[model samples]
Target: EPEVTQTPSHQVTQMGQEVILRCVPISNHLYFYWYRQILGQKVEFLVSFYNNEISEKSEIFDDQFSVERPDGSNFTLKIRSTKLEDSAMYFCASSVGTPKQYFGPGTRLTVT
Candidate 1:
């Protein structure tokens, strides 16, 4: 079966550095999204991408953030500058026009 997968299951960085989180979603899925969970906080949507352009984005996705599809199979999220509060679990998900989403295990980002 197809599933979303992410790299560097865990990452630790300094507060002012940059970080790039990578993910590969199910091949047939058309919609891709990035979301984050700050330690004890609820899951928050960051952005959604489709057809090589951003389809939707939350306020949390500020100028410091960006998303790109480097190839047909890989999707990436980059944070221009990290903050202590950026520590959290980031999830990548995909869906084929369904309410249901297939999610990756997630990449844990920790900033000192």
Candidate 2:
């Protein structure tokens, strides 16, 4: 079975450093998305990229965030200037569209 893979299941970073979270989406999928869940919050969509451009995005994706498909098999999310509020579990998902999406185990980002 195909699955989305995210690296560094746990990340601890300072208050003002850049961090690049990496993910490998399922092969043959047409849509990829980045979502986050704050400790007691619901899963929120950050951004969705397909055909090399953003398809949909949520208010949470601010200027501090950027996403890229650096190569054939890698998808990355970069956060500039981390903040304490940024601590959350970031999930990477890939799907053909709106039916079902496969999510990565998640990278728990902890900022101090």
- Please give the TM-score that candidate 1 achieves against the real structure: 0.97
In angstroms, give how far residue 34 of model 2 lies from its true place.
0.5
Which stretches in model 2 have alpha-carbon errors above 4 Å? Answer: none
Measured by lDDT, the strongest candidate is 1
User: Which run of 10 residues does model 2 get worst, by summed lDDT?
Assistant: 92-101
For residues 1-112, could you state the per-residue lDDT of candidate 2 as single tens digits?
Answer: 9889999899999999999999999998889999999999999999999988888888889999999998988999999999999999999999877669999999999999
TM-score of 2: 0.96
Q: Per-model C-alpha lDDT, please?
A: 0.95, 0.94
What does the lDDT read for residue 4 in candidate 1?
Answer: 99
| RMSD value for candidate 2 | 0.8
lDDT of 1: 0.95
Model 1 lDDT at residue 58: 96
